[model samples]
Target chain A: MKNLLTSFLLIFSLSITASAQQHDHEQHDGHQHSDHDGHDHIQEADPALKVPNAGGAHIDGDNHHQTDGHTHAGDHGAHHEPNACGIVTHHEFDPGALAFHHISDQNVYNVGPWKFPLPCILKTHGSKKIEFFSSGKFNADYHMTGTNAYNGYVLYEGIVRRVVGDFPDGLIDIGHNALGVEQEEVDGKARDVVYLCHNGNKLRCDNKSTLDGGLFGGGITSFTDFSITKNVLSMIFMVFLMSWLFLTIAKRYREREGKAPSGVQGLFEPIIVFIQDEVAKPFIGHKWEKFLPFLLTIFFFILGLNLFGQIPFLGGSNVTGSLSVTMVLAIIAFLVTNLNGNKHYWEHIFWMPGVPAWVKTILTPVEFLGVFIKPLTLMLRLFANITAGHMVMVIFVSLIFVFSKNGTSVLGGYGTSIASGLLTVFMMAIELLVAFIQAFVFTILTASYIGAAVEEHHHAEEHH
Target chain B: MGGSVAALGMGLAVIGAGIGIGMIGSRAMEAIARQPEAVGDIRANMILTAALIEGAALIAIVMAFLVA
Candidate 1:
């Protein structure tokens, strides 16, 4: 069953590559040439605009974002002139960076080009002076600059730090820095070094603001972040939706009593029954009831998140794609499995019965390590698969941008729309199935793990 | 250079997974063919084993992505 699905996934990606046939065929040369020849091509691609160190754009084997490779080869005049400072800022977005951004927390939810900044709650460490504020304080103009300040705080890398400054707009030529420390004498007077203290504590200046090269990481700006990030908000919304849906179903179950289930309960009853009968019963055997609630919660929770991920309009925050979230889920599974382990489970892990002492020495350490490795594998599996799926989907969408002559000229995008759209549809169709498959896979694996932990091996031998 | 190596790594990951899964699938088909009535049981066991292999491959792909 899964083979067909897996084979389809592979075919979908191959066709995607095949669809961009002519252009991709050119890129095949880069792939064959490897690094050195690729660099030479990039360097010689344009000469008029070249500086001593053109620093060949970090194009991957596919030559993505360099769609003008042919035209640029003929006309070096198209290259942008180096800035007056003699430096060309090459803005290259590494795919790993894209992966990181997709799975990482954000203080804002971006839908396409529109950004909706979320509310942030920051408190000074120790004193815990909690101040609730919108991330808009560091919006377009204020972000990463000195001008923006709200409640004597500025945002950097999503962390709120306290800084008291006149800023870029109201630059007061104070004789001292923002930390109020006497600066090195400028014309025999201490040079003014504006500082942003973390909590207005002069002694803790190390928690200083990051703006204008202030010591941010090691400054007196010890602040605990309590921001309402995108994933947090999404998870909260999910919890609320699940609770309401399950509660209504529960009420329906109560009202139906002796009647055949219908409506909402009808929809969920079969799936719930499937988990109980197929997964839990098969794996855990007689002890299925003990872990049913745990298994079902994770199943529904992950299913909800996965289904939500397929809808791109809703900020597309990959909650399960985050390692931290999966890691925590894995940890919960670890705790339950060990906590429910029977005496025999402990004996097998620590000192296996009937095993030779020498063998036990080797087996004990491996078994001990297995305890951590199981959860680790579970974490990595969920996070990576979800992340990979999300990446593939995003790449499908980005192909439009990549085709449009270095992400410029909307005119080129319309031409490539047909091919990209088809690929996107194919990928999305696979993802819909993946969403359910992943949830089922995760639940069944959990059930199987629990089944192993609480299993009575000796009793089984007697039965045989 | 790094990207090429990363691509190679990702390719290797996929290849290893493909072989492992192909073996499992072929064996599973044989089992199902011999006992068509037990298809459901055979399918379940096959998927479980195949998924374990996929998990390992996914981890490798992620490590390769880190390099990319």
Candidate 2:
């Protein structure tokens, strides 16, 4: 009954984590940016740079000076500066130049407001007609109309700009500027200007620049993305998977009592018993009882996280992929391993069984280094492996559409696309297996380390 | 690049450890299958041997990153 209750709670907890409502694949795919309601395109406002192509309404001319329609020898002989998007042209002597306009003369091509969702646009004149550009989501295609020239992204509705002057009238302004759009001139070449945009909304230049902010305050905090719904579900799914096996075994235990184990018990009992006998017994030795719970918790928790890494949406987030989170877990292992270490362990590390005093001093530092290095390696191992796996899967999946640039090449595109999908699925399946292996590895290692510290030196003497 | 290289080494390290561990498991299972009455003794020895192997594998896993 106790085991059954634990299994039930595990399933319930995982269900809460794996709840379909939370996995919102749309949000995970970065489609949330398409839902943006604000007008943030600064390039759409500039009339001179964003002239509709004479050939076709759909064909957008490149905004740079190299384009056919717009020509500028040096400064275009005007004090008017262009927006970052090259959509709006702001003049210095013109009315509202100081009031409605927010362009700064310094760093003439640089756009400010550094963040999005807030209605603001900052622009400045630059040496290059195309001042700032990046393939990130916030920046639009400066070369194509309703499409990204660089990334070939179709400009969805949410990416539309807010115009100030009437179309085909006086000066036209793009991008939402509640405080009136601002700008500045940059000293560097066209591409030299640092482009800013939100990771989620590439069209909105809202990412914190070097002048803005950092991704996280510290390494430890970076792992909290796991608290998201997708991660929770993946972890819970793994726990459910393991719990089912546990329950199957427990039922057999009840039925067979002292008789030979059958079915699920045969598969699982050995592993559980193995951990107890090999890892716990030798490490904790006489004092194993006190630390078993934590060891078990770490084992299960890591196993769940590793399993979570195999799930599609959750794996992409890189929860266990972050070095910080892994570091903390490794630190926990380190603490538990050392705190439970007996006198024999410390003496062996700092002093020695039979080594000379001079040799002992040299060995002590190496031993101390091992303590720090052990946890560090643990963090690196988990983070690197899982993050790489996720990255490869994302790239493989993306290649399907990315390589299909030709509108007519249906056969090649379809074949490669299907192949990529199959490969992605295969990798995901492998990832699931890896998740368990990594968790077991971490748990077993922790046990062994603790066991090492607690093992009797007399045993080593006898062996030698 | 450094990060990518670190990850590659990590994957290799884990794969190596998994293979080594699998061998121990196979041998232990083989022993138990042959002598059914010695299951308990075999189980205990298997665990101890697995732990020793795990320690070595873990150390190698850590060494995999030293090149980085």
Candidate 3:
């Protein structure tokens, strides 16, 4: 009866998400058509404003002219032309960009079409004072471009970016269609530079610096974001959920004592026992008990986050898929492995009793490199697998848009939706397997590395 | 142009990984058939080996992305 109830609940939730996704697509289609109509209306109204091709230089020149005209016309008549600058032109649907955006971390928790704002904590480069406010202060539109700038910061695509030049304090109406992107050369490399238009002036915007150090085209900028973003919120929620669940199961175990596990305990026992028996005991030998807790924690933590990310329309928080998260996990594993390394392990890496001095010279450097490479591989493996899974799923869904030519063809949209839906379901199932496999692989590899570090030197005697 | 070349490199890396994993799977299957009782152990080892190969391919793919 309980199993039936659970299955029914799963089906009900799945249906809800499916319908919500359909509605979202319809709304998006409407938005695209409306924007196209607005663009047509603007072009028809003023023939002089129409350019044969809206290139970068042409747009800039036109924008400057419009801003000069706005100043001469005064503030009252400025409301007559909302998109006077005409920056927000119709762009083709880019699946790659969309996939990246979906997987990337954001300051807002997006559920369906509704965006819930999170608190924003930011610090400027030279300022000692940290600014605190809700992201809702930006009054972000459907496209996540803020209509108002609060304290010189504007929300662009659900992220808070600081205006480059000096601006007034407090809420200032920047109006819609203010944000624009252009390619600019920085350090001999061309990169996208975001600019904001407000009050007849265009201002550059700065993105927060990333620790990747330009490897991913991210480096130092004007401000640093210390906000509790969507990924951070998801992690906090998962931590609480896992704690409550384990506490209840632990309490059950204490009460039942030697009796067979039931309910949630039964569901978890096999998985925990599998890790203990198959992973820990086999890899770590008799000292497995000492490392069982660490192994179990990572296994369950990663597994939980992986499955949590798979839930449709639940913000799709790609926690484990993020490089930063996996890097930290790998760092922890590296620290634990090396810290617990006995004299024998160090000797094997640095000297090697059985090998000759010439071989040692070559092997020593390679062995040293291997130590870092192990953890690096662990980080990359988890990040790549999860990210690729999420990207593929996004692209599969994007196929509907691709075939329909951005909602221009109803027949194509309906035809592709069925195929795309099936593909998404197939991918989801594979991703589910990948979630478990990846978590297990991470744990087992860590255990094996630990096992090698702590293994006894009985084999040395035989070699000697 | 760089993107297309990077994609070609990524495909080459996948080819190498695919071959490596396929060999591991076939060998593991043969071993499991001969010694049915050790299927569990063989499967675990197979997956571990496949993951290591996948790690190499992942590095190549990431390098490709960086190049692009």
Candidate 4:
């Protein structure tokens, strides 16, 4: 217990230092970008003055003072920067955006202050050739914003985005104050488009296409990313860890024969027995043995990923929290339940035996819809619970920055740190419980659905 | 404006779920008090029923997010 407490303190301290570094980098970057923008505005105004057009000179003078005041205000308090179009943008600490970003999968796995690059596999539209390269070539900074663009691709917030249109595309430094977001009409709907300023020209960047078909603010773009992202890496790691532990336990059981379980085997015996006795035997009935392996696989897999994500200062990869992952899990569960469904299940869904004709029509459609809705609910339940848990933890930590005013107030920072730390620890405890409950809930629900599909028609006859 | 409406929808959904889970918890407590030996079965059933109710509330919340 003493050792555990010391390690916990170590991780907490490391995370605090990492967050402080990121906050400082954001402020520093804003200052430099605004200064560069002011210089460019002055140069442009000088050219306008030389033209000797009174109206044009007056407009240019006003623009110059506006930018100067913006920069001056930025210097005294808030961090603000002028975009390429001379619009002053405020850079406040948004906890919501930060939490979302932290939970989203990325091409770079962050462990404390360090970011480890992953392999990038990208394919552009109308191109048969697939591009394979390490994300390290992009030279990503503290914020995961790459300083250099390679092969028309740039790392923005740890995700690889392709630059639109044609240009010289090897390794090129796009320079500071280049990235900006603008609202533009796409297909009659306003969308925030990301653009990069390179050599006095604005180049648009395309986000990776999503399967949601724009329902989630993502649509088909110039490229599709099939990268082994941070979430994928974490999933692979969890699979290997689980496999090793289970395999070891299996071997121990074989050697021990009839002897009582010991060591690691002792630890997992109760959980495995609980699922078998409580979940499988009661729900799956006579066919419990056939589906027990599948139930255990998903239960342990999800539980492992959940606990892995809770580890502070690690990559904290939100694998189970991701919609894509949960969707696939739900699909597999749906397939399993339907495939093993008996004749009674199909008859019950398509036509009720004793119901009136009109009632049967309504019942059939409702039952059919329920078949699909079951898995859909399973997918959303796990995804929402885990994602909300992660987001809450991040928001709790972000309270430190909010109270400290981004570290400008030393006393506030110190005082809020203690309170934020306590809140974070409390949230972590709740999240740990949620991890177990969600995994158990998912397994039991799947069992019940399977049970409904395979049950014999003897009960119906008895009712009649 | 749309965001605020979405938030309101989410809050309403939570309230419904809160009341549902509360009833389940209270009933489970009563059952446990009546029959201490069957506490395990009562607790498990309570969780399953509460999760089913939560599924409905979560669907509403997610719909509000997507629409708004």
Candidate 5:
């Protein structure tokens, strides 16, 4: 314990010293008005200039100028200044921006610097003007406005909206003031300007001009987006994986007849047997074969997807975290439970025998209500549990970014990261257990629902 | 303002659920202690009861989310 304590202390102080160096470097840049950030983008396009930031004329455009009062070119950063998604952002690792980007559905999948647009499919309500194209065509960040158009629809975040304004209404003083957007003179025309928040919400213009927020307006646009979002993609991937695994296992059973279980068969046999014996046999009874397939499929599917959610490399396309997915799963379970309800099951619910006539009146409505309640509860339980786990994990990881970010001291960032990292790991460890236990519980409960539906209570306290 | 009220509602739902599940567990243990032979059946019943309690609490939580 003493050695362990010393090592931890060593790690702690080392991080503090490292962050201190970063702090000094940041301070030097801050004094220079953070001109490096502006030039960094320019360097990407053209790196011929040795002194990338020396081009004083670069401030002419709407590149939300970061130039200082020290430079004669105009302190444009003062007027166009944004608070970086309503929070002071010191760097690109703004947790608020990163958090929502991870949470919400986007039309593009970004892995490091290489970004590829997911295919966006939208159809007109009645006109039937089907538009299918790569979401990258709007140039990733640019909104289809005025002269620029992408198949007559403007993409905002991921919502396809119709652009109707001809640039005049946005420029008018009445509309501009109403929406709290400020205007600037550009090319002999007054233009309303608002900066995009990290998650792509249009906020009042300031120097925090993120490219995500530029498109926010236009006309009578109606289109249904059937886009293949991240969760959908993850679900599709799971379906393919499960199908392949089961099919190969089915083939192996035929090839290795009467032999002891080995390889993939040995791997899955125990879980399959456990579900059949413990979960299916007792609750589902003699007809356990009917529901075993579904129970096994969902058990592995949910288990696989939950594990996928924990993987950082998957880009946070948490399939089960979304409520719609859980709702659909619950609905399927509900149908199977109710549709397969034996005659005796409905008899007990509708006109319960052994109960008094007056008691039946009160019990009947309650029993009826329970039919809907069971499925509703299943939906909520799965959705809430999975969503809560994800939110907790994200919040824990974001603590590192929040502390070390601009305005918040780097030492604080390092300190919080160490503390939060420990907590995050603890939560992650619990998540492993939760991932399995919840799946088991969900499966067992589903089995119980079917069991209750098919149960004949007449042989109570009697031998089999 | 709305968020805090929703949080309060969720807290109440959880507390009530905790009490209910505790009762279910305690009663189940009592039943098991008396009839150890039927432990499998008893365990299944306990889980089902606990799931029902959780289900009820989750309903309230969803309502609170909508309100907030």
Candidate 6:
């Protein structure tokens, strides 16, 4: 009745929203950002400059910018001369900073000269961020470029600037070690080389300003921006909505006893019971109900994330697919598992039942290592599987290009394309299954660890 | 240097898991068909074995990623 109508409306609304999102993608093949259009065509192209594929321009010697593995401004030749006062200024984009793990051929899709669009967005940008493309276009300064493949980069509010240092060598002390306010002598006068906290790009600074037109438009956007997509937002909406609906129904069910669980409640009761019986009962025994709320929440949340990732336009913004994100989730599980661990569990690890005292001393470190390893294993398993599925699919599709490049051998290209396409389809189908299994494995393992943690001899006997 | 070899190991591990799960599923189905009334008992055993297989597969995958 009431539950049925609510569910019907929910489904109806979700389908409508999904279709609307799909329509936007079909309408525009590039990034789905309505806000991007607001900051368009502000900077006229410089007539004096021609876009060159100089890889990236290393302005501060830290390779601040890169294009095709080549830096434009080679080594900052003149600027390298040490200051007369012996004070040196060093600027660098901390070496080994996280960047895209580009899996396809380096020459996939070129934007301007050096910038390449990755198949997926790996990082996020804030409101005051600016992203620079090799094409001399910033998301804040340019309109939609002719290139359509850059649909992954989401540019929010930001500004772009290109400036050069003019201070004399002896007085300009722009070193990282200088704390608080930096003092520099510029033309026999004290000046400031304000270090930009935005990305390590030499040409841009993502200024943080709460007020409109307050500072460096918020932040510098990445060349291939991929922070937000509609599917992610919708999926988030779905989870919260589902959670809210279920909680409401549970409350009502509590109020009305002896009535059959109806609609959304009916759908959820089985899953809740499954967690309680299959996960909690086996692990925690008598104290199962104590952790039921968290376990159920985690199970449903993870299940939602996995399923949402499979949506047509979601791509890999799926946080679960990200190793760092999954690592955090695994960390939470690790913390909870250890925190809930009883004294018996620690004793078992430190001093096992059958192992002699001498061996226990040696095994203590191993047992401790196992504690960290379990969650580390959880993070890697989910991250690798999801990422591998995507990478395999990408490589399979790229095979078409490989054949086409080596003398558009039509038959070979088509044959490989079709074969790879079929394999990709197969992989996608497997991915759907993997999604569920990974979520289930995570939930169950958490339960098992909890069970192991709390399993005292007395508790084990009582359960049996 | 080590990344690709480890990836290969990961692939092989997954292949082994597929085979193991396939064999388990085949046996479980055979048992269920032989005694329809004992489907519940067969399913319990099947799930337990599948979990064990998955545990091994997951551990191997994790190791491969770590080395990579």
What is the C-alpha lDDT profile of model 3 across A170-189, one tens digit per residue? 99888767886666878665
lDDT of 3 by residue, B28-63 (tens): 999999999998899889989999999899889888
The candidate maximizing TM-score is 4
CA-based DockQ, model 4? 0.67
Which candidate tops DockQ?
3
User: Per-residue CA lDDT of candidate 1, range B1-68, in tens?
Assistant: 77689889989999999999999999999999999999877877887888889887876776675555
Q: How does candidate 3 fare on TM-score?
A: 0.85
lDDT of 5 by residue, A1-464 (tens): 98986586557445544654565564455545745445564556444433455555663432343233223222223223345344222333445544544555556665534555667776756676667876666454321111212654444433334333332211111111111223555434344443323223344322211122121121223455677766777788888988898888889999999988888889989888988888999888877899999999878988888877777545656677666677788889999999999988898789987789999999999999998888878777776677677778777766665576532466776677678766766887888877776677788888988998888776762653
For model 6 the TM-score comes to 0.53
lDDT of 1 by residue, A263-340 (tens): 888999998998898889999988999899999999999889988877856777888877767878889999999898
Candidate 1 matches the true fold with a TM-score of: 0.69
List where candidate 5 sits over 4 angstroms from the true fold. A1-101, A112-114, A141-149, A152-222, A405-408, A460-464, B22-47
Rank ordering of all candidates by DockQ, starting from the highest: 3, 4, 5, 1, 6, 2
Worst 10 residues of 2 chain B by lDDT: B59-68
Q: Name the candidate that leads on lDDT.
A: 4
Lowest-sum lDDT 10-residue window in model 5 chain A: A169-178
Q: Tens digits of per-residue lDDT for model 2 on A90-186?
A: 2222322221112111111112212121111222122222212221333422211122222111121212121221223212222321111234332
Per-residue lDDT of model 4, residues B1-68, tens digit only:
77678889999999999999999999999999999999888988888999999999988988887756
- Which residue pairs come into collision in candidate 3? none
Worst 10 residues of 2 chain A by lDDT: A99-108
Error of 1 at A229 (Å): 1.0
Give chain A TM for each model in order: 0.66, 0.50, 0.83, 0.86, 0.67, 0.52
Per-residue accuracy of model 6 over A280-373 as CA lDDT, tens digit each: 7766677788888878877777777766656532334444666545767788889888998989889877787567788988898899888887
Q: Runs in model 4 with CA error above 4 Å? A: A1-72, A75-78, A83-90, A183-191, A213-215
CAPRI tier of model 1:
acceptable
TM-score to true structure, per model: 0.69, 0.48, 0.85, 0.88, 0.70, 0.53
